[model samples]
Target: MGGLATAMLGCPGMPELPEVETIRRSLLSRLEGRRLVAVAASGSPLRQPIQEAAWQACVGARLEDLTRRGKYLIGHLGRHAAVFHLGMSGRLLVQPASSPAPAHTHLTLGFSDGLELRLVDPRRFGVAVVMPAEEVSLYPPLARLGVDPLEGDVEAALASLAGTRAPIRNALLDQSVVAGLGNIYANEALARAGIRPTTPAGRLSPARRARLARATRDTLADALAAGGTTLADGGFVDGDGNGGYFAVALRVYGREGQPCQECGAAIRRAVMAGRSAFYCPRCQR
Candidate 1:
């Protein structure tokens, strides 16, 4: 209905391990004691609309734990848990409850501290599912995702990719293959490993796979240190309005037409799965 609402419908920037980690950290600090006093839905289908009364039922519930499963954030509040997927454009904002609700704010959790945790999704693709806390891990979305790169093992990741014929890049983006890597880090990792994005998954040499694994971990760690990426027109912000770490340290993603930071070669962009993949031909191959 509004620009923010339209924005929510379009895909938000792909989030990698670092960006999700940043969100998890921010929510842990800001929403732990907060209560979910109300919920509201706007411009969303009735079947999945953010139910106001359903959310209100959890009023006064304390956030017992906060965890990240792949790219999703799970908030355990006693017997109930709130699960959120940031989608492509979903954002979670913490602000004073008195602050006017933004137009695309589909879900609001009012806290006793006079603050509110808002789910502002311009595309309306983000979802907030409520379920029993104890069963959260069994939820289909959470259950299907593979190891989170931030907490997963490199050997395991390589083993998972050992026999695949899919492009190494595609394998990296497959949630069931290895959770939490999006296009950005996938490109960066391939570049760092000196592996081509078009390389066959099972074709990677052991040394190269090890390099890729190290690159994946290192790139994510660097992004975590810097915050996260902030793409053009993609205004992802922390509670304080700071840009993400990966955004600041981005080397190849969104840098098409620019020189590669490592090899001085031109960075290139290609479409894969209808999404842009940025890489440096010289460095990546």
Candidate 2:
């Protein structure tokens, strides 16, 4: 096969942490130890200005390591590293060398193995920035985020929340509290933990906090294994162009007015922190 998937897409939407993780896993399988043969930018500039020289520096460099911090992908290419952020609706697709580049493909990283990885984003929000290998953590875009929810220190995360009266739902969205959480999984985890979204973060009993942490970790892990949630809009998908099965297992997200799968109560939606939160009142509280 030439590419990562068999489909062509324009723009979908922002992929949350789990979706981003799934994409990273896909890249790792294809990119590890591969030498980058070329780099090209074909579309308009993304949310940030494209540095032509930075993109060019990737040429002839080997992908030594690949990792994810928050929602960003860090590719160690010899002396330089490139960080990728899939803004709303961005797709990082892998294809064969013979395939024609898709429309709105902002960047392509050609590898010695004949696999071409394309970044397509009609919205032009996706970007790849090249930086010094040793200074990736200090890079401006990644410096302020919280720890990875799956592998990060959960006790430290909970300790910080004990002093905040912020709504538990809204607090989970804060990257500084626990990196890479988005609206959908936040709703799902809270429901799984049987905690109300509107509950104050600091008011969480120690036991509830433990359950929330467990639920958050398990929810994200399960979603990643299931290839991340692909909503009805088809916003999030893996490199293989497949939608996720995790959506079928969702407890409360996007299920407003529908009966709760666990308690049979009517699911409800609330506006918190300017985002919609779906929950079942009886099950959550």
Candidate 3:
């Protein structure tokens, strides 16, 4: 493999907006309009406990729509909606009802068409919950999410960070600041914006903030088009179990010590807020 490909290889990370949006789109066609015939749980708890009764309420309800907010997938089912979050190592797979499920499968929703949607999370950090369809927007998790870079005015959102003293990269990861941006895209966006990840959020000028905002949108758009980033550990995949191709196109997320594709300077890595931030030393600054 080439250097770029080699640099993309790294351990799994959480699914950000792009990965979650990709999963939502991949599952929409197969799941929407299909009646949920059954619901099952593995009795293992995730980030939140799997309430079989709440999920059971979704049974027999036709899936009217599947939408995304931040990193959550919402399935509209009559009076109820099933919400899903693919935590650090979670996956949502669509397979035949008769197909054997992978281990750590927390929740399973059987459709009327012999297909089944499964939530498999090895680390148990994902969530599967059901509540009134009307209440989805009011749900704490969804309600607290800030501006969605793709769906909302990201420039305005970034502007709100003008006074934040946290590192620009960390501020971007704040869901209340820019919903759904994780470390991977945060680092990539900083590189694209010609800003260092360690730069203080409050220190960014208006022009730089605008540049970073645009870079964030562009980075996410590219990742969504590529399906989503699937790390070397194969952490993220679409509902069809296919890995995304964006990892190879990553500019800085996991390329520590690698040559900067733009400046030939070695990429640098910094530990910030317990997560790794990658940046081009010469290009970003």
lDDT tens readout by residue for model 3, 1-285:
232332243235578999999989889978889999999999999988899998887788998999888888888899998889987778999999999999988888999879999999887878888998788889998999999889898888878776788999889989988888888898989999999989999889889988998999999999999999988866788899888999999898778788999878988888877678899988888
Could you give me the TM-score of model 2 versus the true structure?
0.92
Task: Please give the CA lDDT of all the candidate structures.
Answer: 0.75, 0.82, 0.87
Q: Give a tens-digit lDDT track for model 1, residues 1-285.
A: 344443333233756677778878887888776656655556474226666555666776887677887788888877888888877667788888888888788877776778778888776667788887788889888899877777777657777677788888888888886788877788788877778888888878888878888888888888888887766777567654456745656777768899988778888887765556778888777
CA lDDT, candidate 2, residue 246: 83
Backbone clashes for every candidate come to 14, 8, 0
* Best-fitting candidate, scored by TM-score: 3
TM per candidate: 0.90, 0.92, 0.95
lDDT: which candidate is best? 3
Per-residue lDDT of 145 in model 2? 85
Per-residue lDDT of model 2, residues 115-223, tens digit only: 9888888777676789888898898778888878988976568767877888999888888778888888888899999999999998888888889999999999999
